[model samples]
Target: MKNEIKGCIKALGKLIFSLDDVLNEAVEFPKEHFQPCANLKTNLKLFAAALQKIDGKYMARKDECRRLMAQEEVALAKCLCHFRAGNFSMDLLQKAVTLAAVYGTRRQAKEMKREAQKIAFQYDLRSQNKNLVTDSKAKWEIMEQLMADIAHNINPADYQPEEQIAWEQILDSFEEKLREKNLDLKGMDYNSEIEELFTSAREAVVPLKLAEKLKEVAVERTKKQKTLLETLERGRE
Candidate 1:
């Protein structure tokens, strides 16, 4: 029984490492890619299922260990009762001690099993939380990139009156969603907001549009700095 319990512990350790690796890889995939979402969701469900199987096995082993411990206790009690009933002999006393040792060993095994079960439960919860966070972050990153791309491609001045109104409304709706998710970009300048959205998008996957937009923003900023410097020099003269 001791050897069996040890083996179970070792197996559980390996399972934990395997699950961690699967989740890490799933989380690292690019959010803009369809494959990441599909893979992450599928793997997360599979991990949960695997955990269920491990939990079932753990419960079975625990029940068996409890039953064995209870049996040992009963046998020990019986031996004590016989000794109390004046059947005290060297043989009976030795038998009682043997039963006591078995009970002690069984109790230790139960403790180990209980500890392992606690660790497993904690790990399962951590894995579930990680899945949720990664999924949410990926979705947010994809949305951010899409919004940034739209912003970069469409100039406010080039739109017709009706198109401008409709585009603003759409942007407003998107901003509202971000607010609802507690991701506020309120009070941030256009360039700063764009940079932030780009940063968030790059957290999961780097979109080509993001790089192009960043380059454009950088050039615009440099031109503005140059104009400002020229104005200051004229003022000095």
Candidate 2:
């Protein structure tokens, strides 16, 4: 029983460590990039507390540990949805607000909605400017769609391979435009951080199977994104 408890503690410790890494990255992001809910830190704290509750009798505290771990995972995923290279759309922010309502205060949820509306208004004004390049407009619209799809947890497997391939071409074209402008998708770096998060989660004992599925999704997303960037250099020439 003592050994089992030690194993559980070790696994939870790894998960907590990964969550800390991604949350720290989120904190360093610019305000315009994404707004992480303040409650994420609180969620992390509660999970950590559960870890501390472990003793020689693992069964006694097992349920509580499982519950906290599940809650933390949901909160972390919700926070991650808000992260994008540029400003998020009102739709995406509203979705985030809904997801956050499960763990955040009513006041915080209302504030998020207000922020979303303000940003949406600003985007509308920006779209009306005659000086903005056509490419910039197209890129913004496509990225917004992509981010929204991710926020909605759209399964890549749900689409046919041909459809997926076509989307990849679209992304390649988008990345090429960014290359011409000497800009890169900054959110690609966040995907790497998310990949690391799943790597840690996969090590935990309680939700090992679920973690594997999540990691597979994260890994595939990162892989597709990196592939596009890799081809951009040669394709541009």
Candidate 1 wrongly placed segments (more than 4 Å): 1-63, 102-237
Record all residue pairs in model 2 with backbone atoms less than 3 Å apart, i.e. clashing.
Answer: none
Candidate 2: residue 193 Cα off by (Å): 20
Per-model lDDT? 0.37, 0.39
lDDT of 2 by residue, 1-237 (tens): 445445545545554445443333221222332333333223223322322322112323343233333333333343333333233544455555664443333554466667656766766623544322222333344443443223223232122122121223334454445566576444233344333432343233225564456557657755864554444333434
Q: Write the per-residue lDDT of candidate 1 for residues 1-237, one digit (tens) a residue.
A: 445555434443343345443233222112231112233223223323322332333333432132223323434433333322222333434455564433333443344345334534544423533321122333334333443333333321122112111223334455555676677443333354555544553433434565665668747745854654454345435
TM-score between candidate 1 and the true structure? 0.19
Where's the lowest-lDDT run of ten residues in candidate 1? 156-165
